[model samples]
Target: MAKMVDQNPLKFSKYIKTYYGISFVEFLNRLKIHYFLTHVDHVDQFTLETYIYQSGFANRSTFYVAFKKYVGVNPSFYLKELKGK
Candidate 1:
């Protein structure tokens, strides 16, 4: 796909880092978190741990770190805020 797009993997990664101000892995995690949040109601189990795993995070700590970086709060806080709305 990178070759099809006329970019090497290294060059495409550098472009994303430059444009988005974060590493490619961080950007992908943010996207994963966003997707999980927006599409979470489809899941049967609604635990935060479940959500973290579904969001493509390997562990709670990493999920929380990425979620906080992208959303400016912890997932619990985000859920609370969502509930209030």
Candidate 2:
């Protein structure tokens, strides 16, 4: 089995901010929403986790912290809002 490489979420976030003119957390929120919309067939947690992992979040705890900071709510709640939109 191949070992998975660990990603540095903060570094990746910095890059996003440097190039995108948006805060890292904002970029992450947008990514989460985009992922949900693109893969609407998936359940909320699945989409959120997939985006969190794919976007170089160090782990679930970090993802949750950053997500809450940017989104003003938890990932689940954010997903619920998206559904209502």
Model number with the top TM-score: 1
Model 1 residue 36 CA deviation (Å) reads: 1.8
Can you write out model 2's per-residue Cα lDDT over 1-85, one digit (the tens) per residue? 0112354767666667799989866775567655544654465455556666776665778767766776578877866777788
TM-score of each: 0.77, 0.45
Q: Show where candidate 1 strays beyond 4 Å.
A: 1-6, 41-44
Q: Show pairs that collide, candidate 1.
A: none
- Write down the lDDT of every candidate, Cα atoms only: 0.82, 0.65
Model 1 lDDT per residue over 1-85, tens place: 3687899999999998999999889889989888877865644457778777877889999988888988898877877777666
Candidate 1, residue 21: lDDT: 94
Model 1: lDDT of residue 39: 68
Q: What are the RMSD figures for all models against the true structure? A: 2.5, 7.4
User: lDDT at 14 for candidate 2?
Assistant: 67
Worst 10 residues of 1 by lDDT: 39-48
